[model samples]
Every structure is written in structure tokens, then in C-alpha cells.
Target: MVTIKDIAARLEVSASTVGRALADDPRISAAMKQKVQEVANDMGYVVNRAARMMRGVSSNLVGLVVPDIRNSFYSTIAHALSKCLESADLQLTLSETDDDRLVELRHIRELTSVNVAGIIIVPTARPHPESVRLLKMTSCIQLLRRHASLGEHWFGIDDTQALFQATRHLVELGHQRIAYIGGTTDLPTGAARLQGFHGAVAGSKAAAHVREELGAPASTDFGRDAIRRLLALRSPPTAVVLGSVQNTQGALEELHASGVSVPETLSVVGFGDELGFRWWGPGLTTISLPVSELATACGLWFIHQLKQKSANPAPYSSVSPPTLVVRGSTRAVEAANASRAPARSRQLAG
Candidate 1:
């Protein structure tokens, strides 16, 4: 195996100089660093992660914990994170929690045991105090989610502001009877989104028309069930806003099965632009979550934490606003209910 000493001798530099250059120390000039790197590469010298860990240094491995790896939103962010980590010559270890707190705790423990240099997690619904404390053992960054009491590194979209804007859009389109479908009241994201929905509807003339159904996280089955319940209401909503892309798919399927024409009988808006939306159908009107941007911010934050060596220290946080993408799924209120003919015309025709 090629060793650092071999590279150092080949480059005619002291072993300590080679080490500092390899570490990219400020004391080493750029030209010397480049020369040392070139010799190391030519010699096929690879840093042994085990040796570095034994020396009590960074492992150059990052752990990424996500609620559901199957979800496109999470997968998208994972892809971005992986790419970013790779650029920094680091490796990524991924763990799927399936939105279960117990499973997430286990994953966190495993990552720490491996001496991962840093961790980026999308926490489960409620903040787990034990889990939060455990995270202090390693550099941690929270992504695409937030915790209320447990202050720590975080980066995610402002879901409340996003949902508020979405609701206002429907109201501006004259959609007096608008309903929300997705998320249980227990989850922070769910509760915040609900708050935004109510904030937009409060004191409005159409407040009476606003309804909500707290369901599972962005599942098609949940969407179907929520839609069924909404349609059974005494006065069904003319429009619906979905909390996730997965749920939107289910909602659309149920509506199609019921022979309900979209925008004519019902207009819909969903969160997360997601993949294949354009080719799926007429395309869904949605709030794009800026998944890549959030991932990049999380990766950079994790890197910063790694350098600071401050585990469990709460860092400055930021939230990005959601961007609305208008598409074929949503329409004006009059267009949405055009299927209902005037009572006078029906009586005369009869």
C-alpha cells in the first residue's frame, strides 16, 4: 500500500510537511499543497479511515437519517446531500426511520458507534429528548423539519408561510369552500400547516367553508380516505389543498374513480412539485419545497459543525419561503363548479 511517507520522500518534503499539506493546513503554501497532493495521487495514496478514527480525528463519513427513504421528497434531498458530501471527499451513510421514533433512535446510535463525522436528520413528528441528547455526541444538523423545544441546527422551508400562501391563492380564486387533506395534528409540520390554513381563513367571509382532515403522512391511501370523508360532508368543498405529492396521487385516483372531473367538479393543489408531475397528467398545481437548496444548506451546515467541534450547540436557523407553481390541477372557483347547471335551466328543460 502507498503510504504518506512514500509520497513525502518522493516529493522531497519532510513527513510533517506532507501531513500538514494533506490536511490542507494554512501553514502549507498552496503550491506545496498542490505538489504534495499530486505526489500522493500519483502514488495512489488513500487515507485509511480506520487509522484516522483511531487517531481521534474525523472519519470523513456523514450519516443521513430520513423519515422515509421511499418518499421522493426525501430521496431527492438525499441525492443532493450525497453529491455535496462527495465533492468534499466524504462518504454518506443513509438510514431510513420509516417515521418511527424508536427506529430513528436506533439509527442514531448506530451512526455514533461508527464515529460518523457528522449527522443530518429529518426528525420524526415529536422531538425525542433522549434522541436529541444522543445527537450531542456527534455533529448534527436537522433538515427539512424542525423541533419546537429542542434547539439545534436546523434548515427547512417555512411550511406555515407556504401553506398560508397556498390557502390565500385558493381564496383569491373565489374558492370559498376549500378543504385541507393530509397530516395528523400531532406532527409539528402538520400543526404548523394547519395553523397557516386557519390564519388565511380566519375572519374571512368564507371561514365557514374551510374544513380539514388530519391523515397519515402523504400516503395515497390517506388521501383517498380523506377525500371520501370530505365528499360526504353536507356541503362538499369546491377545492382541496393537499399536504404531499403522495397524497395528491391518491386523491386524484379517487376523484377519477368517482367520475369526478378535475377543475370542473374539483380543483386541487398539492405540496412538493415532486418527480413526473408534468408527464403524469395535466400536471399538479403545487408549492415547490426547494429540496436541493435545503439539502445544500444542510450539508454546508453539517460541514461547519464538523469544523467547530461544538456538539449540541444550537446554531442560527433559517426558513425558506415556498414557491407556488401554477399548473393544470387548480382553476377559478366558477370553473371548478361549472358542472352544476343553473336551477332555472334545469326546471325549464324538465
Candidate 2:
């Protein structure tokens, strides 16, 4: 509970002199500033953030809204964000929306109400018009996701390039029959990744046997269901590219239950470097999203936007390319198995 007054009394200086020193005001002499700082440190004094905000000096608070706290990708980013923001002497307020638009909107309103210096959001579901409107009036940055109409201040890996690279990896491995699992076309990440998959497959020999299993964002149940559907196909894929870590776990469970050996009968590549892979007997080959990098970039962007509130914001933004991590779950396709044609690939094209 040490205050500026306490430090001033001990130094026999005016409280305003101590305040100016604390603010790093150039008017305060360097010798006096150092003396005030030493006294403040000795007295265990800390600037009250709430009081500073009230005085319009600094809010010292940032809000972060994530879709799911349990998701490894989001959690990793949150950890990095907290660490980075803390180093800058700022506090973070975190909220989870569980992919519910209403909940996300409410969280945004609450954060804005508290007058946080800025907000970093990973939106639940697609971008809504109302959310865009709210963002226009607030200092906010979108992280690992984007809203179609929201101008700039977004940071996320190039999902499309990641998927395309994954598909091409399978192609290079002699996997002509490849299936994609998780995420529906309506979601931006899903659509972008799908486009990347298609782009890589186009005009390729394996393009004839590519199949997609689109649904809700990856979950254990969804993973099982998508696998079941893929297995039911007359010519099941020899290799699969999974969209999320959750789906990767579910797929592994289903594969194990069916006694299907990974990278033996089927090769699996997943997105996100889930923690489960560390312990799983067969480590999953995954294209790990740069969560920490994205988070740090978003944090820096949020700070920049807060400082440039009056400047015109950029229109639509994204992060740099993602890095792909290859692990043990996937292997070269057997020539005999790879030679078989996929019926669905032909049907879809027809």
C-alpha cells in the first residue's frame, strides 16, 4: 500500500515531483528521477493500474477471447500472449466462448465495458455483422482467425498453404488416394484449408482419388464418424490429412478400435501439434501451426492499434506461411495399395 506520498515524504520532495519521476517526465531531472525510483522501490511502491487508467495515462490491461481453452493451439497461443504482455507490464483478461456467437459477443461487450487498452480475439464460428460493427468502435485485433468484413488487425498462419503442403506431402509419398477430415465449408479456416488441398491436387495424378469429409470442427466423436465414412467408401483413402488436433485424436481412436495399423494400412497427417502425440506410440505427422509466433504478432499488433486509434485501419490481414512438422504416423505408401483408384474422387469430378 505504499503510495507516491509515502515516497515523497521520505525524500522530502513534493508529491508532484515523485509523480513526474514515476511518469518518466523529461521535466524531472535525471538525478531526482533516480532518487525517486530508488525510494519507491525501497518503499515497495507500485503504480495502481486502475488509478492510472482513470487518469487516462495507461489502462495496462488487455482482453483476450478464445474459442476453446482446451484446444492445444489456442492454449499455447494464450500462454505466449500472457508471457509477452506481462513482460510489457500489462495484464491480460481471458475469456472463452466455446464457439458460441452469442457468448463471444457478450464477452466482447464486457471487455469493452471495462475499457481495456485493447483486445485480441479468436472468434467463435464465422464473423457476424454485429461483431464487425462492435470491433469498429473498439481497439481489437483478431488472432488465428479472421472476419470477412473486419478491416485489418488480424494475425493467423496461412491455413491454405499449410493444407496444400500436407496434401503435396502425401502426393510425394505416392499417396494417390487421400482423404481430408473435419471442418465444414462455411468456416473460414475450413474453406481456406480446403482450397489449399484442392489447389495442390489439381491436375495431379492423385487428383482423381481425393475425397473430403467436412463437418463440425474436429472432435473425438466427429473424428470417429469421419473415419467411419471414409472407411465405408469402396476404395478408402490410403492417406488422410486431418484438420485439427481434436480430430487427429478421434481418428486414431477409431483406427485403433478397427485394428487398422497407422502408416501401414493408413497414413495420417494432422494439423496442430497436440500434446497427445508426445505419448502416443506412433507420433502423428502434423503441420504445426505457429501459435506462439501468431500470439506475439497479435499482441504487438494490438499494442500498435491501441496507439493508432485515429489512423485508418488496414483492410483484412493475415500472418506469414506456416511450418510443417513430419512425424511417425505417416509413411511411404505401398506401391500396390497406392495403385488402387478411389471411386469418390471420380464421382465428385463427374
Candidate 3:
């Protein structure tokens, strides 16, 4: 491995001068910095980032933790965040927690121990004690799902509002028997979205129409299972609202398997506008998350924190509002379904 000393020897400059030039320190003349960088590049001299981090120098690495990258929503957020941070000359290190508290805690500790500039996390539903301790040693920006215990800066969507609009859209379309399939209340997102769904139902004059089937983890399997249970009911819902993109995909797969035609037989509204949804048999109506905006805000705030260690920016908890996109998947309830009032009553019975 080529060292800074070797580069300095080739350039006829002190090792200290080479270091300053590589760092682009304002004190170094632009011409000299350019010359040293070109020589360093030719010599294949790499900065000893690990050594500099050990000496308490802020690293150019930022850590990003998410539950599942396979989920399109999280994957999109990760991509947006990567682009935003890269523009500022910072690199991103990703850790997938798989929604496990222990794994989350381990990742947090590992990142902080390596002296990453900061971490942006979509924390697990349950709080881990190790998360609290390690977070104190670094800057953290919570995303999407926040564990109430770790009161960090949060950049997320208005989950409640998102669900409320979705549910209300079905209601407006004359969907009296509507079912909600979503994640458990352990996570803030689950809780907020559930609350929103119920709030819309409670406030609606057609309050008796909505059925909720939450408590399952947010996954494709959960979506599939929830749809099965909903359909098994004597008077199945004429419409369904899914809380996440993964859930939507799973639910739609089950619906397809069951031969239930969308819009004609059942209306559906999904969370997060995944690309595949547009080309699906019927274009899916969904709530579009402002992923780019959320990522930009988190990246900027984290970079600012790294620069001003003492600067206490207000506790930011802003939410990017979601947009409800109408498509071919949702339609007004059929006449036969609307007339089965007694069937709806029995369906809700224990």
C-alpha cells in the first residue's frame, strides 16, 4: 500500500503538507492542492481513514439502518438518501436489522464504535437499552418508524393522515364494508396508521362500514394471511386498504389467487406507490410517500449536526405528507353488495 510519506517524497513536500492538501484545507493553495491530489492519485496513495477516525477526526461515512431493504418503500428511501449524502462527499454504510431489537442494537453499537459521522435509522418497534447508550456517542436521525424511548430527530411521513385519506377515499366511493390490513401497533407507524384508520371510521357517518385486522408484522406473508381471513368472513369487505407496499403486494397476490377481480368485485387502496403497481392487471390506487423529500431533510440535518457539535437545532419531527393517487383498482360498491345490510351485520358479529 502506498503511504502519504511516499507521495510527499515524489512531490518534494512534507508529509504534513501532503495531508493538508489531500484534505483540501483552505490554508493550502488551490494549485498546490491540485498538484498533490494528481500525484497522490497516480501513486495510488489512499488516505488512512481508519487511523484518522481513531484520532477523533470526523469520518466521511454515514450509517443507514432499515428493517428490510427488499421492501420497495425502504429501498427507495435508501436510494434517495444515498444520492443526497453522496453529493456532500459522504459515503453511506447500510445495515438491515430485520426488525430485531438485538440486531438493531448491535448495528448501532458497531457504527458508533467505528466513529461514523452519524446514523439515520428506521428503528425497531421495541426500544433497546443499547440503542440509548450508543446514540449518545453520535448524531442520529430517526426515520419512518420511531421508538418513542429514543427521542431523536425524526423525518417521516404523516402516517395517520395517509391512512385517513385512503380509508376516506373508499368511503367516498360507497364502500361500506371496508377492511384494513396493516402492521401491529408495536411500531409508531403501525400505531399511527391504525389510529388514522379508526379515526376516519369513527368520524364518518358510515362508521359501521370499516373493519380492522391489524397486529400482524408488516410483511408480504402478513398481507396474504390478512386478506385470506378477511375473505373468509361471511360478508367479505367490498374494499380493502393496505398499510404498506409489502402488505399491498401480498394482499394483491392473494386476491389474484382467489380469482377476485379488482374494482368490479372489490376495490383496493394501497400504501406507497410501487412501480409494479402501475402495470399490474389494474393500476392500483395508493398513497405516495415523499421519500425523496424525507431523505433530503434527514441527510441535510445529519450533515449540519456533524459540523456544529454544539449547535442544538430544534428537535425536528416534521412529516412529509403523502398524496393519494387514484387509479383503476378502486370503484363504487356494486348494487348487490350495497343491498346486503343484514349480511354486513352478521359479518361483524363475534
Best by lDDT: 3
Any idea how many clashes model 1 has? 0
- Candidate 1's residue-wise lDDT over 119-143, tens digit each? 8888888656778888876777778
Q: Give the Å error, residue 299, model 3.
A: 1.7
Worst 10 residues of 1 by lDDT: 341-350
10 residues in a row with least lDDT, candidate 3: 341-350
Deviation in Å, model 2, residue 37 alpha carbon: 3.8
Candidate 3's C-alpha runs over 4 A off are: 308-311, 334-350
Q: Highest TM-score, which number?
A: 3
- Local accuracy by lDDT, each model: 0.79, 0.78, 0.83
Q: Backbone clashes in each candidate structure, one number apiece? A: 0, 1, 0
Residue pairs that clash (backbone atoms under 3 angstroms), model 2: 152-316
Candidate 2, residue 149: lDDT: 62
Question: Distance from true position, residue 197, model 2, in Å?
Answer: 1.5
lDDT for model 1, please.
0.79
lDDT of 2 by residue, 1-350 (tens): 99999999999999999999998899999999999999899889988877876666547778889888888787888888988788667798889988888888888887766667777888766655777678777677778677756556688889899999888888888888999986876668888989989998888888998898887765878988999999888988889998877888788788767766666677888887767764454677888777888788777666666557655667547677876788776787875356334312221100
* TM-score of every prediction relative to native: 0.84, 0.84, 0.92
Predictions: Cα RMSD each: 4.8, 5.7, 4.5
